[model samples]
Target: MTDLVQQAGIKLDATASSPEEAVDICGKLLVELGAITSSYADAMWEREQIFPSAIGMGFAIPHGTDESRAHVIFDQLVFVRLAKPISWADDEVTCVLGIASQGDGHVELLGNLAEMIQDEDKLAILQNSDNPEEIAQLLLGND
Candidate 1:
């Protein structure tokens, strides 16, 4: 998972004036890494249209629907920390975590992520870190 994040790319302190731009930043990285097709980004946007991805505490997980799974070539995760918070529906989001998985791994990934963020210290690190590697370590327990 950490390798996927390193390969997919992480953008720290990135500036995006809107939620769409934030999602685009992470999606583009996945596309560049060949983890997903270009259309996957649009799929993410469409999913967002159906329901906001913001999960709370300034974090948002933007992903495509099962129908968009066809665009996924591999399991990948892209983390982006915005330079400023953007409105994702009713929530203010500063971190956009983009996920592209081909199978049930996405469910496991989300489960792990949920557990990780439940720790206040870990959540603080994720919300405040400016180093991509450090953030990855904090999230994936690579440290």
Candidate 2:
């Protein structure tokens, strides 16, 4: 998972004015790494059109829908911390966590991430951390 984080790349204090741009930044990295096809990014955007990905508490997990799984080459996560918050539905999002996974594997990853981010202190630490390795460690841990 740490390898996935490293390979997918982490953007701290990224300059994206909107949630779309933020998700795109992370999605493009996954495309560059061949973890997912370009269409997967489109799927994410489409999914957002149907409903916002922002799960609240300043974080948004941008991901493709079930139909878009065909574009995924592997399971991966891309973290992006925006320089400014963007409106995502009813909430404001300053962090975007892009998830790409083949088949049903993402369910578990999403569950774990949800649990991890539920801790306000942990989320605050993640938002403040400047080091990618440290952020990855906080997310992936010793697993």
Misplaced by over 4 Å in model 1 are: none
- Give each model a TM-score: 0.90, 0.90
For 38-140, candidate 2 gives per-residue lDDT tens digits of: 9998898888888888997788988898899999988888888988888888998888888888766566666767877787777777778787777777777
How does each model score on lDDT?
0.82, 0.80
Best-fitting candidate, scored by lDDT: 1
lDDT of 1 by residue, 50-96 (tens): 98899987889999988998999988888888888988888889888
Positional deviation of residue 19's Cα in model 1 after best superposition, in angstroms: 1.4
